[model samples]
Target chain A: MLDHLGEKLIARVSIGDFVVRFDLITIIMSWIVIAILVGLAFYLRRGLRQNIEEKPNRIQAVLDALIDVLQEQLLSNFISTSLARRMFPFISTLFLFVLVSNWLSVIPYLQSPTQNLNVTASLALLVFFTSHLLALRRKGGRRFLKGFIEPYPFMLPINLVSELAKPVSHGFRLFGNIFGGTLLITVVSAMIPLVLPVGLTIFFGLFIGLIQAFVFAVLAVAYINLAVES
Target chain B: MDLTLELGKVIRSINWTFIFTLLNFALLVYLMKRILFKPALAYIDRRREQIASRMEAARKSEATATALVAQREEELKATHEQARRTIDDATARAERIVSAATGDAKKEAERILAAARRRIAQERTQMEADLRRAYAEIAVLGAARVLDREIRIEDHQRLLDTLIDEIDEQALMVKR
Candidate 1:
């Protein structure tokens, strides 16, 4: 059981001539995270334009402060305010989703979706492709294409290798952190029923989870910033 | 547990070409974007704009107030300076009037005193003349009585002269 700590429980479904396999825990937990986010979003949507001015309720205040802080972080990272506002929806959503997903594992009998490489890759590739597409659209086809052969003809292959490595590193970084935490947690829990120590759970689930989520969101914004600027 | 076997499993865990996660995440982003972030960020942006405009208004009002205060101070200072000038002018005019009045009064007093001195001199001359005439008459009467006859003009004349000369020797003027 300790050796098989990282194994996923998969579910298989067939459609026409094809079959699809999904990690059951990740899928189930992904929906739960989505549901929670969606419900909170509905709560946020209520009374948006009303006079809740100066002094807002607790949840509204937190959301307000969170959005403001995130926007400032992007602006401070050297992006224009307009550009930051435009990117706010996507960047902040990523942060919220990742943060919730990372923290979800703190609950008993649950796991963070970030434990899966597939989801991490999806998120990293989202930023990766978004940045490149923005660059292509903004800089035009010729300039964007010429970016690979930048500085010299000899640098093209190196640039391509470096470009290919972005998604891999971006995805793997989160996966490694969350998965390692999960494994340690599992081994410790198996040693003692229900992960009794509690201290280790707090360290991995709360502390590392928050840091990784923050790092992921910031890196996503930075990558997008570089792409648009470059 | 062999690290090699575990490495193989981890490497095989990737389903690189699959679209399930890609679509799901795309949905999540779309929903999350549509639901949560859109309105919240918009509210924040609107609030910032309101704050900036309100501050600008406050600054303009403050500047206007300061300017008004300075203008009032300038007017007050001018009034004070004018009042002082008026008071100084009034004091100079009063002193000039007092000095002119004193000079006029002194001149009038001197003229009255000179007139009084001249009147006294004229009265003294008239009384001396009258006294001599009275003395001449008395002497003529006395000569008439002594002679027991009517007095002659030549005798009268000599008597009068002698009496006048005697009166001159006294050298005293009569008081009223």
Candidate 2:
């Protein structure tokens, strides 16, 4: 099994000096994630009945609970249901994609894109651009630039450094977590040569995956809100 | 000695690739926004509206049920009041009937007592007359004995007849 997993990882697609690897396992796992999301959407949309006599089915109940939690989070934290509603889909999609990608690494032969610095960096860059773009669009370029000069003009360099650090730290955070988990699982399996490492790997991988995804999505929402408001 | 300069040249050459990656990431974000994010948001918005409308409908139905319950309570109260009024009227009517019966009974008792008193008075008057007659007869007998004379039977008969006729005419005047 280990040998097969190694062979699966070894496969790659290279582009000149840059290598854009495509693995059968990763592709297949990504498809599974997409299918699950699409199925959930369809079930939520089609299964809910409007009649008073009809009771909510299992899928509807699950969907309702999920929406309720999201709504509460948006209302309490974001302070605006309209903005939460507007932003929920994009944020949820990002969370699910990153989470699924991270969790894929726990499988025997699959790898997570989030473990790659390039991929994580790309995602972080997206957030960064989105925040600035929304800020500029809402507050205009002058106001957005004026945010750095607040409290004292001498702090502008510090503010600029902080802004530059945002994407780098965000990307590195995801990459480190996923990559470290993969390395630890690999080392443990090599030492144990048993199924114990698999369980530990799945557990830790899922925990880290969910946490990272939540952090990323929450930070994105906070950044967008802050950009638009201030 | 020239390694640092060579590194600097390489770094300068790599700036274009970095710019290209940034542009590529921007394009991907745009594509994702169009293909995945917008439709998903639309679907979510529709679902939210559906849920909100359902909640509103449930609230309206609850209000309607409350109103119906209040109406039923009011109707029951009115029915109870009507029953109470009917019972009160029936009780008043029963009391009036009982009072009228008692009054009639009292009047009937008084009428019977008056008739009995009148009858008793008439009997007493008759008894007095009989006693007076008896006394008169005894006196006549005594007079005849004391005289000790043999008077004719026809003369005695005529005297008795005269006395009887006088008594009869007196009785007739008293009756009138």
**Between which residue pairs do clashes occur in model 1?**
none
| Residue A43, model 1, lDDT | 80
Instruction: Calculate each model's fnat, 2 decimals.
Output: 0.30, 0.03
**Each prediction's TM-score versus the true structure:** 0.76, 0.64
Q: Per-residue CA lDDT of candidate 2, range A1-230, in tens?
A: 34432233322334555653333333355556565556556666554445434676676567667666655653345646676666666666677667777887776666785665555676787778887887788788788889888768999999888887888888889878887787678778887969888687877689889888878777778777776786
**Chain B vs. true chain B: TM-score for each candidate?**
0.48, 0.50
User: Where's the lowest-lDDT run of ten residues in candidate 1 chain A?
Assistant: A47-56
Taking the tens digit of each residue's C-alpha lDDT, what string does model 1 give over A53-148? 555666777677766677666445636666676767777778878888999998988889888888888889888998899789878999998888
Task: State the displacement of the C-alpha of residue B56, model 2, in Å, after optimal TM-score superposition.
Answer: 4.9
Q: In model 1, where do residues sit more than 4 Å from their true spots?
A: A47-49, A52-57, A192-196, B1-11, B16-18, B101-176
Model 1 CAPRI rating: incorrect
**Where does candidate 2 stray beyond 4 Å?**
A1-76, A189-192, B1-87, B121-176
Q: Return the lDDT, model 2, position A209.
A: 90
Q: What's model 1's overall lDDT?
A: 0.77
Give interface RMSD, every candidate, in order. Answer: 7.9, 12.0
Output candidate 2 Cα RMSD. 9.8
In order, what lDDT does every prediction score? 0.77, 0.66
